[model samples]
Target: MKKNVLRLFVVGLIWLASCSPLTRVLKNPDINEKYQFALEFYENEDYYRAGLVFEDLLPNMAGKAEAENVQFYYSYCQYYQNQFDLAAYYFKQFYDTYRRSDFAEEALYMHAYSNYKATPDYNLDQSNTTKAIETMQDFMNRFPKSSYFEKAGSIINELRGLLEKKAYSIAKQYHRLRRYQAAVIACDNFQKDFPDSELKEEVSFIKMEAQYEYAKASIYTMKIERYEETMEYYYYLVDRYPNSEYMKMAESYFKNTQRELYDLNP
Candidate 1:
């Protein structure tokens, strides 16, 4: 019980020690003194405190020489705190306002990078992912020789991979749900969007299967045309992926489609 009481007292003392300086800096009326303390906090990697001080100083420092550094450091504080959306906004604001500053290029790059960091999972909405790619591409275009160019390219490719995965999963999900027509359309869109995807072979096979199923379920008047479409898909699949793992199933689909078409015509 005594040790516990002593520990609690020590913890309280440590908290007060940490908070005391920040409290003093916060209450100080002198702008230059507060700005200096803010930089000290930032240099010490106490970004939370530094951000608080910077936020307070920002409005008062407008049009002053210190405004630029304050804004730049403020953005960094947000980024270091993992506040990516806010970081992206502030970084972009910094670049737009200080295009001629030496840090402008870095600010723009961080703006793109922050968006990249903000991208959601493959299963989630990818509007932010697309925006990240565009911003990174813009960064590369503006700074061709930038040290960050390779990193930006790599990020773009990674985000594209996520998009490809999402698109493929959606197409495959449609097939699994027995939504054949939607599956066929989604498969076609996926192939068109990611012609170089490693999943192209699987997507083609799914398209063939979907077409076959769709034709089988169609009305008498539409059966012949739909089966004919299935046959066309099957031929395309076999022609492109002659040795595919899905070849056996694909050929079965083809034969079924051919038989159906023959019965309809006869």
Candidate 2:
């Protein structure tokens, strides 16, 4: 049994070694041979090997007649194999190195999509989301006339919403822990950072609530002054988004703050 296992392993190694030399295959008039071999590997689901062969052909094929098709399918092989990061890198190279190619716009879009695929969950690292959004935005800016405009725009909106949600979560956590000063600052930053965000209503509500809580925790003599600041926030919320559900809540707090001032001074 052990001998049979060892024999099988040796046979596999020999097979791989024979295929390894295919990486050196480049464009001659013999491009057809390399293409045929790569197609066989690709159809057999041996994407890694197919990608290897394609990448090797790149430098030699550059400026040659077959460059465009080779680079396009190379990117596709990486993409189809779920190597999104590598696919994104190759797509970027294709876009930059072959700007005049018919595949340029499509390659650019795929570059952005690859990064978008790499984005982590909202609660995890958002670095990829940030990168994805920025890359998509840049792609849109560069290729506004490209067919990818609307798709890229939709991706930008989705990524922006995720980032806003992260900021709101951090601010809310601070508020929930009674870290009033920190919460106030964080909430303020969120409002400024995403002024036109979908989170405007929730942000305004949190800002008002945090201001009121901070006021409630003040010294007795400073309570009136603090309440005055708190009232300003509520009024701001009501004025800025009158139709918001949060406005009704803010109105209740505004009345409460006014009553507190009267009671304290009377």
Candidate 3:
């Protein structure tokens, strides 16, 4: 019975504290005491309340030694509270404003991390993912020997994966939609841009298939030249990826191209 009563009492106190007006702290007569309490709240991980207090304390504590920590945590508060875009902005601000401060490196990383958090799945627009890659690459370049090197490299690769997936999806969509001409160009670009991608064999094969389809769909004057070009692509893919899973399907295109060559020439 006593434990139950104590639990209710604690819950009630938390409710009251959360419902309490933040202005009470902002209007406190002693700003120094108010700032100290804000830091205490942040240390306790009550970041919402801490952020409220920090917001009020920022102007007062500017240029002070404590401001460094306050600014750094303010961005973290934004991050923890799930305001990732704002967190990214403020983290960049912290890095720029206190470039020489010990927190600068972490702030830079957090800026990129905030963007990474905002970056969504493969199907969504990937502008934020692109931004994160750029920002993280810059961070890695600037801090090559920093402890975050491996983690940063991992994030860059992850971002590249998203980009590669999106590019492949779009190119494949062109092929699926029967826009074989566009698919040919898109697939070519994808191969050129990401030659080392795991999707290399698939990409090359699809472009070859697209080229064959484009040739078939072309006018009489264009068919011969396009078919010849497709044969070149088929040989290239077979030469490079003899064991490709796509070889069976790619072989069909090659046979069709060969038969059409004789018919077109004859």
Output the number of the lDDT-best candidate: 1
Worst 10 residues of 1 by lDDT: 15-24
lDDT of 1 by residue, 143-259 (tens): 999999999999999999999999999999999999999999999999999999999999999999999999999999999989989889988988998999999999888888888
Q: After superposing candidate 3, which stretches have Cα over 4 Å from the reference?
A: 1-21
For candidate 3, lDDT tens digit of each residue in 1-266? 99999999999998887667565677786878887888888899989989988877788886688888888888999999999999999999999999999889989999988998999898889999999999999899989988998999999999899999988998999999999999999998898879899998989999999999999999999999999999999999999999989999998989989999999988
User: How much lDDT does candidate 1 score?
Assistant: 0.95
Of the candidates shown, which would achieve the greatest TM-score relative to the real structure? 1
User: Residue 47 in model 1: shift from native, Å?
Assistant: 1.1
Could you tell me how far off, in angstroms, the CA of residue 209 lies in candidate 1 after the best superposition? 0.6
As for lDDT, the candidate ahead, 1 or 3, is 1
Report the lDDT of model 3 for residue 26: 70
- Give lDDT per model, in order: 0.95, 0.84, 0.90
Question: Which portions of model 1 miss their true places by more than 4 Å?
Answer: 1-19
Better model by TM-score: candidate 2 vs candidate 3: 3
Regions of model 2 farther than 4 Å from truth: 1-32, 43-46, 59-63, 218-226, 242-252, 255-266
- Name every residue pair that clashes in candidate 2: none
Candidate 3: pairs in clash: none
